[model samples]
Target: MVDADQTFVIVGGGLAGAKAAETLRAEGFTGRVILISDERDHPYERPPLSKGYLLGKEERDSVFVHEPAWYAQNDIELHLGQFVDRIDRAAKTVRYGDDGTLVRYDKLLLVTGAEPRRLDIPGTGLAGVHHLRRLAHAERLKGVLTALGRDNGHLVIAGAGWIGLEVAAAAREYGAEVTVIDPEPTPLHHVLGPELGGVFAELHREHGVRFRFGRRLTEIVGQDGMVLAVRTDDGEEHPAHDVLAAIGAAPRTGLAEAAGLEIADRAHGGGIVVDERLRTCDPDIYAAGDVANFPLALFGTELRVEHWANALNGGPAAARSMLGQDVTYDRIPYFFTDQYDLGMEYSGWAPPGSYDQVVIRGDAGKREFIAFWLSQGRVLAGMNVNVWDVTEGIQKLIRTRTQVDPEALANPHVPLDTLTS
Candidate 1:
């Protein structure tokens, strides 16, 4: 065990950083742990912001990972509303922007997470144009939706990824005319294969959501500093009272890069590279969560996942590695999305063009089914639509790498557990 007086400085107070601190304590590390976060509030769960929280189904307090008392009880110092300016590796200290204070650390964990990718266009700075990344964004959106009731208000979402889709569903449920525009052909095509992506696109379309796929948003039009309409690249104008830019996120790697750490490009977009143990080239500093592009054991590729599950799992893994415990961060990747009463779950890894066959279990038309991506007669990945049990079963199969007959997999009469044997 490390000395109790040793100091550990963790940057960012998001899920990964918070969980790492908690895990450190749980593992008998009674050290001086300080969690520095730029946000004013304590670390809170961000997943619900685009779904239940935005729709007024979940409260702000309920979405928080821990209350103020929990941090105090854990003996973790919470430095809220403080920005980390730079990391001096030679001095082993972090400089803060608030007071120009420098704090030394024996070990540091970089869980800086990510920020929303902004568009460089006119009227993007307008009042009604927003991006859903923080609690403030969700609160602002809720306020706008409340003032402009669904029947009269129109919401135009600039991206068709998970966040945009969830927000579109929430806006539709609130009685607003919603439109989703994306440059990609289908929503979730980058993660889910084209077949499943088509089904997801169809599902959203059937629920009163208008989709303008394969179109780029050129500019936003504003009147008196508030959004009035958005223009597409094809010169089509959408008269939207509110606009949401959900074009995914970019890694918060400025501090790490400035510290001379080795960073690499992500497969989908902007992220930093990390090894299997979530360690950067600078052995003293480690990174995880959304900012990291770590190697996947299942896919044999380095991928970055911006999901709550990844943050929660990867944080502790990186923390353990930081504590001199050589643990391999090789768990099967899993993520879930809740949209308008629909629960979607995905597990395992499926790289692009890796799957040779796909087996559909249950009925997609019924809004409940599991799609399994098979490579070499083994399940590589599985996507569950409102079917949790099937997802749990597929997770096991993926971990075990069990071989199963394709015909039995498609048959609803057969139990999912039978495929494992």
Candidate 2:
């Protein structure tokens, strides 16, 4: 039976918050649970926002992570369209804007995820300039694309991250001329390293997408409140009918900091600090998903991964810890992207200059290959394009820390399954 006196209040109705609430119930916590979400709609998956949903291939209803009736059946109090104004840790109360209602909690979970980092350059507030971080943003962008049609539209995307690449793919599918600009030498170079990033760069180029590497957007020129062109740092102006900013996201740690919790700076310099159990400095409050920089046992470093798998898996780990269960949030980070006709999967983490060896399996020219990164004889990371099974096998190898003869891994004839044992 749930303790009637204990009430678990979860803030931010995104995937992390919703999953935490569900896990609490699954773990036999019968306490009164209240889930507060800023969005009017129930929690939904966000990965599709830059892909299928933006392209109109998937409906909004299909993106929902869970149904409203499911929450009701689970006895979860749903507080939709509510913004948490402040958190009082001493009083254990949350001030929110739900018809001026105040809610208190015995235990609190902060799953408030990050928002898109916008370019502060000129003309950013123009009608044609946008950012893709929320459902509404994607919907608005889709509407513009549909209205403009395919014939004579141009989309200039800022940043070469997953979102920018996915949007570039979608825009090209709509027959729009797409150009992606980034300061990095290649897309995802910081995470995937330069060689694998070069493969991706080539992949996008073959799809008729233009790339402006080592370039940064200095200003957005607008006429009558609609963006007309983008001025780069090199003083060159590129005409663009639409502009989408997908630079990256910063952690939403205002609530945690307001609660007087010690917020440590990320090793990579922009995320929040949390322990292995996803607990912040204040033990009573826990943070997960994109907002928390949890320690990665595999890398022996604290990192913040904004991937779908991390949010889904880490949320429950935070909830279990809150329930007094000893659980550690450590897993090989994984993320996937759909570009053109190919699906790419990435597992584990290895920043640039960390990996000592890289082995390419299969054929990159054929667009089906697996790239493996090894550090000190341990599999540190793997990237697969149209070769998911190979990536899965690599994941197991990384998890088990299995040592393999470097030459055997590079040979195409060697079965990946052989590494499982």
Candidate 3:
């Protein structure tokens, strides 16, 4: 076991790192704790950046996980706005910043998180083109997007995953003439599957957002270092005054990879490989959140969920593992998203194309339903859309792996508790 008097270092300024720090303190660790972030702001949540904060509904301070004073009060050292260049695993230290400062650690947790996948097309480097990943990025976008909406100006978004869809909804709500471009026939087709993915596409269509499907991005057209349009392989040009590239995220695994840590599968978003307890190949090193491709015991799969709930749950679990506690991070995956009037919560892992049937309750047209994806009558995954307060029941049904009647699952007259009980 690492000595309690030695410093336990955590790298990354996002929710995962912040929560890990909080866990260390809460678990009565008397050791020195150092939380480092590349961004100047304290650790904060990223979910609100695309929705509420982008829409001007939430304040900047509200997004932060902890106020600036919390670090000082807890005796945790803070290093902000500095690049973490390297991890010298043999020396048991992390070397960072232009100054080459070395910080020794008894144990280290790398919650480095992921970066927005870049568009390698022309005009991406032009002015008025943006990527919505950080608070600073969202802060810059909010005013411009709102102004674009007010002026009826055009905004083109590349890719149609969660970020792309949510930003389209938000930019449209803020009054920008929004158009989403993706090569896939339907948005979120890979994960949500074609049927459910079409529902989100229709939702955006109903809200007056345009989409360009079956077309891959060729180049971003620009004039005077500013975006004017986006060109796709289909030879179609989309007019735009501003552009957002939300193609998805790639894990920031350079530091770990350079340090010779076992990396996870690149086909599955490539992250540092960690066991169920979030321990890496190096016993003194650990990982969690978006960067840890840990085993999902629930579905007998290896997946890293880049969602708020995973970080919130995985951080504490990793901390417990680091403390020499007998722990297995077996929590089922869960995530929720808000777009316009629609809200949703999803739980459980549907192993890659393994669901045998999809049973839905309530009205899809009315946008109120609970969708269950099952394999041979066993619930594999479940999602509740615009339905209030049933996540716990849904998660329980998933955890218990209960086989149920599709008729019972689809019946609104039958309470969810009845099926699970």
Candidate 4:
């Protein structure tokens, strides 16, 4: 059923959009594939922006998805530094760039991704304030970290989320003093809950990172267009040479909203609503990556995952669906983080209230353990810290929703595969 005349338009140049174009060709579509991105750089993965790249351990070219010649060799139309302003759904045309070049598509895909949520406080426009969503941001931040390290300056981070903590670790590696401020009692409170959040707090503290908990950043005090200090609601000022706003990211659904596509409410994590096949309200259009909110039958809930894994797999799934292939995307939510000496991978979704108890195996004191969240003896989620090659077994336990004895689950002697069996 391949249509030679059909054109598939992908909006956004992030990993999801780029991978979708790759999938289309690999699936033998042979249709006109056009990818438009506002960023001048080619498609790239974002994990390195906070990890190896920020620490200057990896080269700038490592983040890109493919070589520049790949697109040209594949006969895919690559439009860089062009923003698609509007989508005329009735006519199936997208108007993009300054001259408003209109391109018609047989099927449209939105991988528009997300933007970093900005700090509303004053002095955010100062030269030393930064956000880490794009490669450009990381490039600027790398130089800022290096300068801070060279001058023995201080960095004040506004949030203790993944981005904040990762950058804090990277800054420490560069020998910069770091202070993390968060309203929560501990870092990663929402994701790991208080039970395991303390582990990360301890890990950072051991590395000499300061934590200013139970407080909000009221304002960024700057002088002469450079950050001087940060003030907390408690009326205390901390000296800072640079500030990082890692508050989180908001999905970019403006074009989809304008196109009249169904958008999800905040309770379900605001994003464009999509079905199992990743098809939006308008059948001819579909969505993937951080922008799409699709159902996870395993959790019996709708989730809009903003992690790299979601975008990595979701893009290909959406492409197959768009190609009229039978597709049902129900992969378990997975993400990993590397900070200082601790490397962890988490599988399944278990937010604060979803699980009743957290069972831990191995040694939490040694920073090598697997923590499992359970609800009435059913495995909801699992996180393995510095414990290698157990992701497959942990994922199986969650997918099967296996009921196990708490003692056995907590005993490292008992194999994970045995519990599932």
Candidate 5:
């Protein structure tokens, strides 16, 4: 039975952890709640880190999930800048901080999140090299972009993924020169495939963002502890005042791994494996957000989504399940991106090789269109670029698993709701 004596401990101070704590209180759990985070800042959302905040359009204080007073007001024990290195599953305790402070909990939630993948090449420690994952990184880069823009300096980005492209757009808007280098033939190749990926490449190119595709960063050349340029595998040196590594992020699962919890492999997105209830192998331990690989009944697959939407909803779902409430985490995989003038929202899973054909509605050249990824006449995923308020219909199409007619799906006149039926 739920009681006030029980304690719940949450690790990681991101959106998921904060939302989980909020849900616990809303569900009438009068237990002791402790939230530990290595970051000194309060729990915050990450979308702004790469988008509005980086563009200098949003204030720094706006990134925080809740006001500083919210935690204490809610009676949550907020421990900032504390490193939790060990989880003693047998004793239901976790050792944190250099002083080895121990916190006992009846239930533990791991929302440790992910860290940005570092550049393997040399000169990564140079002053001009940057990686964006935290609020601090964004702050540092914001200043760097402003200075680079004023000086008409050049920024070379390694990786053409979401982070790389978003940063590229931000830099361009700041009037700084940008050149994105990636080994893939086109940007976002892994996620959108060549067909739609080309659209992004074209979009970036039109915005004065240079693309050096089919190449990898061999080394970051620097002088006097500051980046000078980057050399690609083709022996071409690109002059760069700054270098941004936007490669990717790996889930933070060291604590979970040390606790002997089941972790998903790379194929499954390399995260702590959780059931539909968001419970790990241990009955008392649950995980959510970017660090969790949970089953998606709608897709018949387990996925670790590193998007804001996943963390936003997954936290509350895990909290309910932890409170012994019925929970099934089957939300459709959803993500959106803003690049230059293009704003895109994607729903469902349609990684390369999963979809047979891509059908488009509206005008691609006009930068207003919706692309549907289909497999055996079934809509696997749908992305609306510059299109608004159709997420519900798109998700319904995916949820119903309807075999949409390609012609009707591509016709702008045909409504999406009719396709689901």
Candidate 6:
């Protein structure tokens, strides 16, 4: 039975918030769970925004992390389409939308996620110009993609990050003429490095996708308030019936910052700083998911991971920590992406450009391989591309930090266990 007087308020109705509520109830916490979300939809998984959902492979309901009735059945109160104006730490209250009443809470969870970084270029707000971070954005983009059949629908995509490439792949499948524009000579070079990034670039190229690399969009040319084309820095203009900017996202930390929570500086990913337990400077408040730049005890570093796994796993950990359970959010960070026929899963965290070399155990030409990032003969991180049932082995190598010969590690005949040993 839930306690009548105690209340636990969760801000942001994303994956972390929904999971936090579920965990609180499953853990037998008899306190009120009030989930507040500015978006009207039920808390949903966001990965589908670029892939499954955008491609129409997933239904609208399937994108939701929880069913509509789950909250009511579990006795979790929901405040959908409502924004939180402010958080008063000293008063232990959350002020509702401007002029709304305060909702008192014994404990608070800041699970607010990130938002797409928008372009400041001219005509960005015009029709047919899109930036995706929400379900509504993806839904609107569906029409533009379908327009490919009506006429020549040319899509000009800005940025070549994970989301950018995935969206490009999905758009191409829909028969749109996709062109990816980015300042980087190679897509994903910042994350995967040049060698692997080149492979991905080749993968997309073989599939008929065009790339305008080493270019930046200076303006979005428009006609009668609708986007027509994008002008590059070098005075080159590309025709665009629709434009999608997948530049990146920034952590939504306005509420946390307003309440005087400690936020990490740019060097540490610029998110709400929390300890290993996901507890903020104030014991009464905890943060998780994309907004929380918590310490990684295993790697001796801090990360603000905006991936599904971190949000899915960190929610329960934050809930347990809130219930005073001896907990540590110290799992090795992991993330995955899909483009064309290539699917990749990566585990472990190394500082920016920290790995000295990468060892490959499978054929890159065939796109079936496990690539390990090694520093001083020890595995620091690894990724498996189009390889099956090897994530466990890859993660173990990262967790154990085992030193292995580069030659053995690169040899496919050598069993993964033997190389680690």
How well does each candidate superpose onto the true structure, as a TM-score? 0.96, 0.96, 0.98, 0.99, 0.99, 0.97
Instruction: Compare candidates 1 and 6 on lDDT and give the better one.
Output: 6
User: Tens digits of per-residue lDDT for model 5 on 86-148?
Assistant: 999999999999999998989999999999999898888888988999999999999999999
Model 2, 319-421: lDDT tens per residue? 9988888888887899999999889898988788888999888898887888889987778888888976666687887887788788888787888779767
Q: Stretches of candidate 4 above 4 Å error?
A: none
Q: How many backbone clashes does every candidate have? A: 2, 0, 2, 0, 0, 1
Model 3 regions lying over 4 Å from their true place: 1-3
Q: Model 6: per-residue lDDT, tens digit, 1-421?
A: 2355789999999999999999999999977899999999999998898888898898989999888999999999999988998999889999876468689998899999998888988889888888888999989887778786357689999999899999888888888898999998899876777767888888888878899999999999999998889999999999998889888889999999999999998677888999989999999899999999988766778888889999999998999988888898887888898887889998887543788888888899999998888888888888899997888887888878888889989998888877666
Q: List, residue by residue over 254-309, the lDDT tens digit for candidate 1.
A: 99999988777654445667788888887778888998888876666777888899
Candidate 3 lowest-lDDT run of ten: 347-356
Consecutive 10-residue window with the lowest summed lDDT within model 6? 143-152
Q: What's the lDDT for residue 99 in model 4? A: 100
List, residue by residue over 215-297, the lDDT tens digit for candidate 4.
99989988888899999999999999999999999999999999999999988899999999999999999999999999999
Give Cα-based local distance difference scores for all models: 0.86, 0.85, 0.89, 0.96, 0.95, 0.88
Number of the candidate with higher lDDT, 3 or 5: 5
Task: Estimate candidate 6's alpha-carbon lDDT, on a 0 to 1 scale.
Answer: 0.88
Candidate 5 segments whose C-alpha is farther than 4 A from its true place: none
Prediction 2 TM-score vs. true:
0.96
lDDT of 3 by residue, 296-369 (tens): 77787789789999899888888878888898988788888899999999988774478879888999888899
Candidate scoring better on TM-score of 1 and 3? 3
